[model samples]
Target: MDYIAENTNFKLKNSAVTLGKFDGLHLGHQLLLEQVISLKKQGYTAVMFSFSYHPGNLFSKKEFELIYTEEEKLAKLRNTKMDVLVSYPFTKETSNMEPEDFIKDVLIGKLDAKIIVVGQDFRFGHKRRGDVKLLQSLAETYGYRVIACEKRKYKDSIISSSEIRKELKEGNMETVNEMLGQPYSILGEVRHGRKLGRTLGLPTTNIIPVSGKLLPPCGVYASKTIVDGISYPGVTNIGFKPTVGAEKVKGVETYIFDFNQDLYGKFIEVELYTYERPELKFNSIEELKQKMQEDIAFTRNYFLKLNEGNNSSYSN
Candidate 1:
């Protein structure tokens, strides 16, 4: 993927582009991306216009949990096979530009967009004055095609980045995974922990995810961990160990069953598949160990049954 940083010596001539924040690259964003990809095949170079920061983050005091980091977003866009990725810095000066100026100066003048694709609810420019209709009018004047992608709905709900974040925050992994086209994953490096699990005969690999990430609710989850391109089924916990009288800060720790490998200081991706149960305090260390054993057993059975069901459906 070609990365074009803001204010850099980079320019594209006559490109087909999609404009959006594209936080999670959820189904709705994917629809617009698909349109852009289709345009690329028709002899148009595809470009994506996105801001470095979410617009709301600039004005609002409350921090929003992002589904992916900037690197992750670029990776996702690369999968769409876009020819160029244009990242516009979100500054007060850029934000103050009028909607018309943004289209004429940035989109048309800088990128030279021959075709533009966006979602139905897409908006841009100062105070978000540019709507789909405004974009269409501008495209007509500039001799470019304007495509508005319809909203995507799944399970009677709009598949939006905000909705996906809400689902993840609520521990609704199943729905979030469906909307994301894969399991929601956290990419991080394995870090050293207190090794309490090791004392219990269940050594774990602890991970400290990047800041501002949307973590799943504190609990045990059936997950798949990938390290150096190899995947392993595992049980992960995202919480403070209340039973062992640990601190209140959040953490993600995973125990991969039937696998032993030294992974300290290595980057890995942990994909949450399903929510098992919430974190709880146990009366005794023996009780906690016993419950962990049960959790592992349940996870194994659950995956086996799930695979069997998939095989049966395929046979049918």
Candidate 2:
């Protein structure tokens, strides 16, 4: 997808667009994006209009966890086959625009949106005065169509970014994976640490994640780490190393099985598949080693069961 960072630099032809924060790119966001893709098949160009920051962040002092980086968001947009991605900078000034001005000046005049797909509860402009009903009225006056995507329900509850955030905050890996259609991931560069795991016979790669990214609750998890575009089954610990007396400082440590290479300064992506166990404070080095062994065994058995299920499905 073509990413246009500045609205002033965005010069695209008329297109059908979906507008949202798209924080988690959850199922509800996916539904809206699919509509934009479908519009593209009908000869309208598919575009996505998104804000660099959360809409609420402009109004509140409270900080929020982001589900994806700007790069990750663009990648997800590309996967939806969006022709253009218009990333508008969210600011106090931009937040103060009137609803009609946003539609006429920004949406119609700048983006040249032939149609807009938004959620039912979608609102914009000063004090969020713009709603679906207002958008429908604006569409009639501006000579464009409006598509309001309904809420996506999973197990009698609406799938939302907030719900996904809650699941992540609570360390509900299974629910998070189910709602996201994939494992929750964290991307960072490998950094040299004290090599405590190595001294304990389980060498690990340490990473410091970018700030503001949501992480799973502190625990050991079954994960897959990607290095140089290749994935390896691994076990990860997200905690302060309570066993090693480093419990006060948070850290992310991963030990990729059957793989050994210098990874310091290399960027890696770790995807958490399942939570194996919580961080524990062992009484001694031997106790910690035994627990580590158990953790690895559990991870191995989990992958074995996963592979078996996959093979069975294919063979049947």
Candidate maximizing lDDT: 1
* Per-model root-mean-square deviation over C-alphas: 2.7, 2.8
What C-alpha lDDT do the candidate models reach, one value each? 0.83, 0.82
The TM-score, computed over Cα atoms with residue i paired to residue i, of candidate 1 is 0.91
In model 2, the clashing pairs are: none
Judged by whole-model lDDT over C-alpha atoms, candidate 2 comes out at: 0.82
| Candidate 2, 1-316: lDDT as tens digits | 7788855555566789899888878778888888998887788888888887777677778766888777667755665677888889888788899999999888888888889999999988898899999989767789889989889887888888889889998888878877776667887889988787888878899987766678888999988888887888889999888766674557789989988799999888888888988888889999988888888888888888877777322111
Candidate 2 regions off by >4 Å?
Answer: 6-9, 78-80, 245-249, 310-316
Kindly list the per-residue Cα lDDT of model 1 for residues 85-171, writing each as its tens digit.
Answer: 777888889889999998888888888898889888998889989999998876778878888888889888878888898889999
| Maximum-TM-score candidate | 1
